[model samples]
Target: MTKWKAVIFGFILAVMVKSFFAQYEFVGLLIVGFITGYLAHDGAIGGMWNAAVAGALGTIVCAILFIIIATLGGSLFGIFGGLTGFTLSGITSITVIIGYLIYYAIVMGITGAFGGALASKK
Candidate 1:
């Protein structure tokens, strides 16, 4: 495959993987995919295989980061609300959780992809 093809394929694959991990973070995934495409084009990895590996690593890293951030944020927010004696409706609670997940995706995905690129030198 040509260089361009490898880049495109790797980007798409990266986006798909990111989306699978976090359904509500499609835009985040797309941004990461674009970054991976740039890295692939720059020969940071080598080809599609390397790009795929990098992308997968990036997704895993971001997933872990997001999980941690979201869980902690949610728990902390809940605790604060409880301390203040704020009663949250079911829908409100759900919305808060989903909102945390969205924040996690954006922060984690971008940082993780850059981290993956930095750590991977093949």
Candidate 2:
């Protein structure tokens, strides 16, 4: 498979695993890196690179989605309570997301390289 296609497949599988392991934040993300690497089918370096990209993208997407969902839920709560939607503005700051993105990218990159080595051997 092409590199992008492998990354897409890896990302999809990572989401599924993440959904199941949602309660364990670090574990979920680490598993995502492994899944991305295994499915990458691009040998060591490629798998590592693809998994890192997928992991970074996943972190960003999940953060945004979480914020959106929280906002919607807040809106619903506000409607029932006759209050305006409470903002989670502080948590949604770009700086926070960037910090998380960097952390995840680093963790996933190293973990993914390990996974990629395993994949290439198999």
Q: Which of the numbered candidates is closest to the native, going by highest lDDT?
A: 2
Given candidate 1, what's the lDDT at residue 1? 23
What is the overall TM-score of model 1 with all chains considered together? 0.30
lDDT of 1 by residue, 49-122 (tens): 33444455455555555445544455456545443433344445556555644543444345444534554555
Off by over 4 Å in 2: 13-20, 76-92
How far is each candidate from the true structure, as Cα RMSD in Å?
11.7, 3.7
What tens-digit string does per-residue lDDT give for candidate 2 at 37-61?
Answer: 7767566677678877776776677
Candidate 1 runs further than 4 Å off: 1-46, 76-122
TM-score of each: 0.30, 0.70
lDDT (Cα, 0-100) at 35 in candidate 2: 68
